[model samples]
Target chain A: MSIDDKNVILEIDGLQTYFYSSEGVAKAVDGASFSLSKGKVLGVVGESGCGKSVTAQSVMRLVPSPPGKIVGGRIMFDGKDLTKLSMAEMRHVRGDRISMIFQEPMTSLNPVFTIGDQLSEMFMLHRGMSRKDALDASVEMLARVQIPAPRARAREYPHQLSGGMRQRAMIAMALSCEPEILIADEPTTALDVTVQAQILDLIIKLKEDFGTAVEMITHDLGVIAETADSVVVMYAGRVVEQADTVELFENTLHPYTRGLLDSTPILGRRTAGKFEKLNEIKGMVPSLYSLPKGCKFQERCPKAMPICSEREPQLTEINDSHAVRCWLHIPH
Target chain B: MGPRERPQFTTMASYILRRVLQGLLVLLAVSFVCFCLFRYTGDPVLMLAGKYATQEEREMVRHAYGLDQPTHIQYIKFLGGALKGEFGKSYVSQVDALDTILERFPATFELALVAILISFAVGVGMGIVVSIWPKGCVSRILMSGSLLGISIPTFLTGILLVMLCSVYLEILPAFGRGDTVQLGPWRTGLLTLDGLKHIILPALTLSSYQLAVMMRLTRAGMREVMGEEYIKTAWAKGLSPAKVILKHALRNVLIPVVTIAGLSFGELIAFSIVTETIFQWPGMGNLLLTSIFETDQPIIVTYIMLTSCIILFINILVDLLYAVLNPKIRYN
Candidate 1:
């Protein structure tokens, strides 16, 4: 995408993940590729089970074992291959240069610890700061996140705080080290609409303040429209469309992408009727284990062709930066 | 008015108070049941008779301890004496019951303490190891071994150890009240440092099964906690596995494991009675056995109440600890 430039901080290519079970393997993420430039936001938009969050985890190599297997991928961050790093080496990158803000903030923070203990640990461990200094920095970070009465709140455990406060605390902790890239895996998915807007604003401000690249993984198309510079649309376990955010919306390269936009009730559009009810995409995201032969989306794609089921399509550039893997978009 | 707030302490406190009151009522029931059963089963007068005693002499002996009184009257007098810290005299030893127990308390406590410590260390350690590597052969073997430990009756285990390690090998003592030839003044053990020589076999017999039970519970606790999203979030934040397990997993897992441990302490007290009878370790277990053998009903009732009370008290402490570790809980 045009948004991902020379300052690219994280790049993932050809990632595949499968969950092993007695019934059969469930391929969670088949092959996906995208990059995030420094100080830019790449929104990964997909329905549930479309492997949007799995791609984010693959970059961090946080996938669980036995059931989860990453058969192919390269998570390139600042010239280093994260997938190849030893467990010890991965530790240095996980919280230092690259951090993650998980969905469901209430469950993300440690329930047994006070907010202060969880926060100070980042400074105490990474910078070898003294306890008092770490504590002060944590309090300062809390204030920066707009938490009211930061000092009093710091002493309270996770359960003591409200939903909005916990989300902010998670963002504050993630930004304390000022990482080069922040992977937010649906940070506001569990929050109410108003709180969701506040959290998104905080993420954007933090990204701009620290020049941190943000990978925003979410299912909400409205969030993508409001903030993302680039967008990657995942279908089943593969990326079906990748382009600059404006271009993806203005001239969508995949039929699935078009269906998603048409389904959303937007404010500006004046249609024939007051507003036709949203046309929900038919059928469910297919089980990844037995994905359609050529295109994972062909089973539901309105423009599905005979060849679409015969062979897998490669991610190919349709324009200077817009990429799509559908046969219909390929140059004939 | 904030969303996702914890319930107020007043509500949780009332719930906890109810639980505690119920526990006390249960203890009272246990006392009554033990008292009735003890009298119905055994002939205290006949058992109180020594190596040289005629039928007329046994009747006179029964009258001396007030066995001649009706059951209800005997209960009231016995209950009254217990309240005054007078356990009455042992029918056979002719010594104050409390004095005999006090003389034996430290020895029993020492053995139980050592066994408890070893149980926690070995059990939790093995549990963590197994959870970390569940598919490995060692995990399977360790977990299976713990189940076997829980199933085997403690007395049988004690007997088997005596036969296998003592009677055949003779490396560990088969039986003795500590190791001294002449029991000396109370200065650590009944017979100086030599008493340790006798404590070894009994302690091992006591620890093995306990260690197995603890290890099983610890493993399950660790597995459940490690699967939590917070743990995965910690990993993605770049925290090493060691920090994740030690700082996060251990503390959180201990909440349930600690309660189980406190409950097990009560079991240790019960198990010791059978264990001490077999191994002769000069603990409260041995004292209870000897007093029972001599049909000292007053002393028997006192010890039973004491054990039940200790259990009740420890369980209350455990519940209080739950509220402390989890601030969401409150005790009245």
Candidate 2:
């Protein structure tokens, strides 16, 4: 999609995050590029080990060093390249201009601290609010996330709250500063199905209320359908396809994206009064340490051409609002 | 999310009561072992009356000390006296054995406290430093130096310190507790300059091994905690690295480290025998050694019982600390 430059709050161009271990250097995110517009939800869909989470971590500058490093990337935000910002400068941007929530709410909150103490820490650190004022703000923020009896819940520890409640508390803490961009990295993946829907709704509602852009990373396309306006499909650390959610689903171009859609179980779709066998893409993901020179998806693509084994396909635009990476889509 | 009904107070109280009861049972078992040592180790009457005493006089001494009574009767009398805080007389000095040990306890307690405080401060500080900059030269040196601390024997460490600080340098005293200040019933070497100088060597000696252990534990714990989801959340919240390490990672690291520290403190108190002998410090270890050499059964029994008591008490303290450090640990 042609995103208006002024409306794009965060733009990631050619991001490369690699993990160096005793075995070898694993390119976790190679050439990932996407832009998040203001007050809109952008879904990042991929299977496990597809670099979706790493891309998010890179944006937050939270990648663990030594083993993991963002070797290349230009994360342009607010007229500055975030990747080049010093740690001190980045600290100001994080949680103030951009905030992130994680998948495992159960473990994402500090266990030793009370919910209020942890949430108030955000205000204390960035806003320089007094402890008492920060705590009051924490209670208000908790209430905004629809946590019942926010005042009492604030005094409780992470262990005392249910999974859903803890996720809400996490959301409350992330949104407390009213950040311009919110990154939810599979925010509801670890919760119950019912709670997942609630958390997603809460995020969407809060995003609208605060006019904050959101980058929602998850493997579940259903979540994208429910909350995302646009979707980015990633495979083997590369963005293979990008388009508006409805347009991409209606006219999916990438073979890998087609496989993902076919694999998902649909409601009320039966054959001979029995559920049909679900489709699954063939072959495991290529080892990141020793990826083949051709398309990363060549081994698994049902429609792979001989050229797919010779040259890696670059992301190519098929139309004004749709892009795909495949030999079929590219004029070669 | 409504007010979580916390019955924590009652559970906590009952938990403490149960632990106390268990402690009493352990003490009872220890007392039985001590009583066995008193009965079977040697004839106290023979030692007290000496080779020069007449047979009739020896019999008279045995009768006076309840040694002539049957084992069960003697045990009952011993148990009764123990309940009233009496532990018979020391064969060497003819003073109350319990009183003698209690008098020496202050010296050992003071030494142990100083040793643990020093070890904890320096060890944990080093651990934080190394964890933050695992590859820095300073961190590498500290880590390697900690290896030496762990490898060296306590007595050897004591002797080395004595040779360096006492024999070679001659700036600090190497032996004895020096001039002590009496505070109520407790005698301490902490308030006076001479006393402080005198304690430096022995305390350093006593702390070396514990310091190494604490350093390693904190380093590993901090490293592991830095990888936790919560720590990443802390960073994403726009917190400085210092704040994230100190507030988020350190608290979690302390959970396991505190348990070890508590146990290590007890160990320092019980096993400072070699250091005490090397430095001629007037601590319980010295008293216990002297009693063992002189075959002062009463003092030996009392010492063993007291050491067991301290260990058990520390265990309870560690358990309580776990509740403090991690809210997931309910007292119940």
Give candidate 1 regions above 4 Å deviation: A1-4, A20-26, A265-276, B1-27, B34-76, B163-171, B177-187, B190-193, B330-332
lDDT of 2 by residue, B1-332 (tens): 22333566768888989999999999888888889888887777789899789999999999889888899998888778878878889988989998999999988998999999999989999999998889999999999999999999998899888888888988989899999999999998999999999888999999999898899999999988988989989999988778899888999898888888898899889989998999999999999999899999989988988898899999899889888877888623
- Each model's lDDT: 0.81, 0.91
lDDT of 2 by residue, A1-332 (tens): 67788899889999999999999999999999999999999999999999999999898888888689999979999899988989999999999889999999989999889999999998998899999999999999999999999999999889889999999999999999999999999998899998999999999999999999999999999999999999999988999999999998999999999999998888777855787788898888888988887999988888889999899988898988899999998999
Tell me, per candidate, how large a share of the native contacts it keeps: 0.73, 0.95
Q: Can you give the DockQ of every candidate in the order shown?
A: 0.47, 0.73
The segments of candidate 2 whose C-alpha lies over 4 angstroms from its true place after superposition are A271-275, B1-6
TM-score of chain B of each: 0.77, 0.95
Q: Please give me the DockQ of candidate 1 compared with the native complex.
A: 0.47
Which structure among the candidates has the greatest lDDT?
2
Residue pairs with colliding backbones in model 1 are A94-B238, A95-B237, A95-B238, A294-A311
lDDT of 1 by residue, B1-332 (tens): 23323455556676678878987787667667766855676776666776578988998988887888899887777667656767677766778877777677667766776678778888899989998988899989987888878889877888998898888988777676554442353435534555666676777678888788778788878888888888987787677789999888888888877787778777676558877888867778887777667567757866777777778877878887887776666422
